[model samples]
Target: MPDNKTGPFLQGITRLLTDGTLGTTDIVESMHHRIVHPPLLPSTPIQHLITGIAGITYRNIKWSTRLIGKGIDKSLYKLAPFLGEIKDTPKKVALVSILNGILGDYLEINNNPLAIQMNLKNQDRDTSIDASSQACELRNVKGRILIMVHGSCGNDFQWNQEDHNHGIALAEKFDKTALFLNYNSGCHVSSNGKDLNKLLERLIYIWPVPVEEITIISHSMGGLVTRSAYHYGRLNDNGWIKHCSKMVFLGTPHHGAPLERIGNYLDTILHVIPYTTPISKLGKIRSAGITDLRYGHVVEEDWKDRDRFELSGDQRNIVPLPDGVECFAIAGITGKTSDKPSIRKSGDKMVSLNSALGIHKDPEKSLEFKKKNTWISEETTHSELLSNKYVFNKLASWMK
Candidate 1:
């Protein structure tokens, strides 16, 4: 028999399929409309007939699938109450994390089971941030705290990939208590940031010992979330901000990811062609989190009430590093060296070197990262930065 968690996962999948089908139908219908009435380009009579039939077929299939999916979801919900509880395996956690990264905002709005809640874990168990619980569960609690935040389509457990957990390694080497954050990556960066701001405030207040210093090590999208959190925390005068002394951003797309930008461009080009416009809408089907990577939008003002899929130039608000905090950025390059312009432009296969290092053409938009504080590793993948020995040495030196 399947466990309680299985029901929600199944239901979520069903809903996703239903939405996808409906979206496809809408795209086909739009293409048919454009074929019948050409705006910029003309379509043949046969093209019109073909799109019309395809549109009708897609609509019928969409309705049929939606009805069947809803019926199955209801049955699953009924059986969920009687299902046995199951322990979360690493594979299960990873799958849910990917789902959250892709459709996290939808899951959150629908209260789906796959939407991960933000939690602090120690030795694979929730600490609950309660003073007594921390004392009992974290025997090695100390004044110094190291918080590790994972990236897009990832979870806290992923940080321990291939027996290389940076938080554990850093804790062992630096004598600081380490905490891992597991959160829904599909949500807007600002939304997660605001929640993190509150969570950190509560954590600092309930710590077992007097907190002397706090360091955040963030990877990829986690860096944006952390920056957003700090932005809100400072605005609200959160006390935890004072304790945060250092931040290390690993493969962070400080400017934005070029891949997402390319996706946006394709979306525009597809919209211009009436026949392929629906396919263009498919390109826009990526989650809000993925869209945010286009310009590293972190604050509410950056994306509120905006059509995220609209083709637009950089509109991100300038968010400089927090004052009085030592900030370090590390960018990875897959090339043998950074001397090659092409390699530098395609840093780590996901983030560009300039973006990772917070280098901007406009000086006002650039983050003031001192040369001594920034490091670049050639022939290193973005994921490898999490476990690279040289990267570890740099992190250790900064912390010390």
Candidate 2:
């Protein structure tokens, strides 16, 4: 699916040479950002879509999961020692909102505004032009845009430009428009999906000229948001899905993260103590930390349509790709080795090969890749999948 244009190819190759080497600090910065900013609850978009309100609702429920066991209260106190390790989530959310708001307002159209009117009317004619002519016309066509959706606790800045992350490399290689998706990771996946749908609707409606294509590359929980946007967010309502020719997911837990379950279990153990004053009235399941820890929210039975998805058995699957979209996924794994480099060996401290691949209690219901989209690299930790050269190149090849 690589673009037929040479301009993008030259631009990409030029950037690769100019950027030179990647830095370790840059890699750490990317990881640091993911540890802090979780996305908003998925319900955030539901409210907006159904009720036309932008606010979130909370219902406080005691952490009853802890009350089921004996002597667990004393054990819970032991975990108190670990509570200090939880990062400053609130500040992270604030920073993410600020950063994304800035990008959406600034980079989206600030430098190269779209044309006054853009639609599919003359696309066939436009496609007939030569490469140079097409390049010249594209200069006036507003750059090709890639909308990136970050995983839970992720920010737009998480993909460091200097690093090997997929978004950065794809942006560099394509020389198209690139916009990072930043949202409250604490929100529910479905909510964010709906919000994204709305956001896309607004973007196209207001685009300077007719948009030809849009690519969405997401990581971890971000993939769920992307799916939810498609399934429930009404993205196809306005030809949005048609515009999205490519979708790439990097280590996205299609089934949900196993680490989240562990954290939720531990949190339940901590909530039993009567002395532990709850910081917010939000329900235990609804809290930002616990929600991600628990994966997607359990809704009505109809919502758990198992037949709707495909699994990889271990991080691979022929995802229920939206109609008309070319979808693929990249998963990170820690190679079995004694001398592996630091970045290559670790699967982002949080996500592991098992979880990244969506291997869960029900292996039968996991996502299976129709074909190996491409194994980017086993060296990078989970978070580094997007930056890895192998993955990015394969993706760039697909995009073209």
lDDT of each structure? 0.84, 0.50
Give each model a TM-score.
0.89, 0.54
In candidate 1, what are the lDDT values of residues 1-400, reduced to their tens digit?
A: 5446767777777787777777767876776676576776778888777777886787788779888978988997998867666557888788889988888888898777678888778755655452223333466589898989889998777787667888888888988988888888898888888888888887887777899999999999999999999999999999999999999999999899988999999999988876787678777667888889998988988899889999999988889999988999999998866376976768999999999999999999999998999999878898998888888888888988
- In the range 47-157, model 2's lDDT, one tens digit per residue, is 345332211110011122223221343443444444333232535434534332222222123221110111111111232121112222333344366777776556655
Q: Please identify model 2 stretches exceeding 4 Å from their true place.
A: 1-143, 161-169, 233-236, 271-293, 296-319, 336-348, 358-364, 374-376
lDDT of 1 at 381: 91
Cα displacement (Å) at residue 22, model 2: 44
What are the root-mean-square deviations of the candidates from the true structure over C-alphas?
Answer: 3.4, 19.6
